[model samples]
Target chain A: MVRWEPGTAERLQKVALELFATRGYEQTTAAEIAQAVGLTERTFFRHFSDKREVLFQGQELLVQAFLDGIEAAPEDASPFEVVACALRSAATFFPDERRPHSRTRQSVIDRNPALQEREHHKLTTLATTVATALRARGVDDVAATLAAESGATVFGIAFTRWLREERSLADIAAEVLAELLTLAARALRPAR
Target chain B: MVRWEPGTAERLQKVALELFATRGYEQTTAAEIAQAVGLTERTFFRHFSDKREVLFQGQELLVQAFLDGIEAAPEDASPFEVVACALRSAATFFPDERRPHSRTRQSVIDRNPALQEREHHKLTTLATTVATALRARGVDDVAATLAAESGATVFGIAFTRWLREERSLADIAAEVLAELLTLAARALRPAR
Candidate 1:
């Protein structure tokens, strides 16, 4: 999706996170955030339906894009491999410079339950979409669900590492995914 | 910690899920559920604050109880050991025969974004709480976070397995945690 209101959405989100941290998420109002950005409540609604939504708009896009990518991926790929590749493909959407902003956004979501929940919904939706794509490619329902949901575990690791300033998102993602493959191999291994 | 309105909650959940399946989640009303249950709308509100909350009330308590178990564990235990033990301890709270109900409940949440978000909030809160508990036991923040969050990943695996009717919740949880530990150790293997 194109960025509407140009920098206005990010501006409001930045102000909202700052206000939420200082004054608390519950204490901050959309009106206050909009006013801080020299915009009206109507403008705030136009950008984000609610303060919680501000923390999640990019994530929603990420989910949709990642799902779309999976749907368009080649047929006959392993379910986990397909979703993993799709997850990696999303790296282009998150540049190295976005790390600081990404961490700050996570912090805001971390502090508030409502925002956190919205984020979780987006994530779960992404996983399910991946699973559906897998099923379409001939993976059974059980394996599809496992592949898609388990892939989120690796994604979470990549995402957390991406937020750190030192490692590039691409590098961290590669490392985490390599580790996830290792983990999966071990999970599939019978106790010896 | 306790099971109040056990059969009522379980029954209401089933009827609601069936309604959701047939008529869609948004169109279903509290009045309809109440009438289906041979209860009044007041009774439905008494059990659940709102229609959405109905699907969510027990999980927070469950995760919190699991965290509390870990925090109260022996001081010298490894992080995974504590979490695994905590999960085993928490198993005492589950009903003896409710796999079908559990699966159905998850299906309901899976279909509804709002409900799914609430479930995510509960899960993230549990991980944070588990991390805090580890810190209280003198573990540092990063390791504790990794252990706590990874423990949750294990729990997620165990939870998915438990929802399947193939095995009892307690037994599947034990096996799955073992699987997670193996997976985690591979993911976090120390450099030689």
Candidate 2:
């Protein structure tokens, strides 16, 4: 039987990121991660399916925040309003404290094609989850899909900007959302 | 030295698709595809890097059509209009005759996660290409990215509908574009 330990998952994740940043993702091993944290490989596996999953630990919370926000939105809110609110609520998931770690993780992911693919998959899943939530809220199919995808797009642009600039995620998200709405308004403007 | 043959690539693609549909994608081999086409595996490699490439043969033509349409769009066209025109022009690339083949290929791809990832990657690349084209036309970065991604979303929805229904690709594309515009208009409308 294995002994249970406190903060094993968090410790493993921090150590794994440090190792990946220093030695590169491909060169790092799960055994090395566990050894660095003074835990068994079994403990590491119990937390993350693989080393790559360490970088995506917050995905579940992000999705939940989005869904919860949509669910809690005002009943009469427009589709875009609901999505905007959901995004604003989800922004809190990435608080100021986590920004540095997220930036580091994104940098590591940027260097690897496989990690990029996984990230894209995660974003796609998030969009789908948001769409389902919208549908459940009685929004029509196409509107729900477009709103959810638009939300995902805004999140991506905001997150990238937040990483590079000093703006908060909420501020960046609000700015991006307004920009998208403006773009949409211009693009959909009636021909004279 | 291998003898050059006419229609070899087309023959290989047809034969490969047949094999994939009948025997499943994972079960089919490059050797089997070449053997069925009465060519060596060398010829198959010359035509395609791998089996999955056969399913995605039209990606290049699709990208080219989108780029050409964007380039040829009127100077006064909005980013969304440019993308709409580009999508309409690209619709011609998928006439009714090819729908049956595309439907089969899509069915095969839908069953496999790896193929879906490749398809998503291809769509992402197309969006980037379209965004680059828009940027070249003097559109701002954020708008260009949004327009291009929105176009990709429209194309995906239109293509899926075209495959399932009897509507022409152009008709389906136009309808989807209009719906997107309407969605945008409603979503972006100022709160009363």
Going through the candidates in order, what is chain B's TM-score?
A: 0.81, 0.94
The value of fnat for model 1 is 0.00
Error of 1 at B93 (Å): 6.7
Candidate closest to the true structure, highest DockQ: 2
TM-score for the B chain of model 2: 0.94
Return the interface RMSD of the candidates, in order shown, one decimal each. Answer: 6.2, 1.5
What is the per-residue lDDT of model 2 for residues B1-192, given as tens digits with 9 covering 90 to 100?
Answer: 122244888888888888888899999999999999688989899989988888887687889889888988999998888998899888888888779888988888988999988988888899999999999999998888888988988888889889999989999988887776776677676776
User: lDDT at B169 for candidate 2?
Assistant: 92
DockQ of each: 0.12, 0.56
Error of 2 at B111 (Å): 1.5
What DockQ number belongs to candidate 1? 0.12
For residues A88-108, write the lDDT of model 1, one tens digit per residue.
666656777667667777877
Which residues of candidate 2, in runs, are more than 4 Å off? A1-6, B1-6
Model 2: CAPRI class: medium
lDDT by residue (B1-192, candidate 1, tens digit) is 555565876678779878877787799998899899898899888888988866776776787678777867777776656776677767766655656667777887788877766676676777888888888888765556656666665566667767765766567777766554443344344533
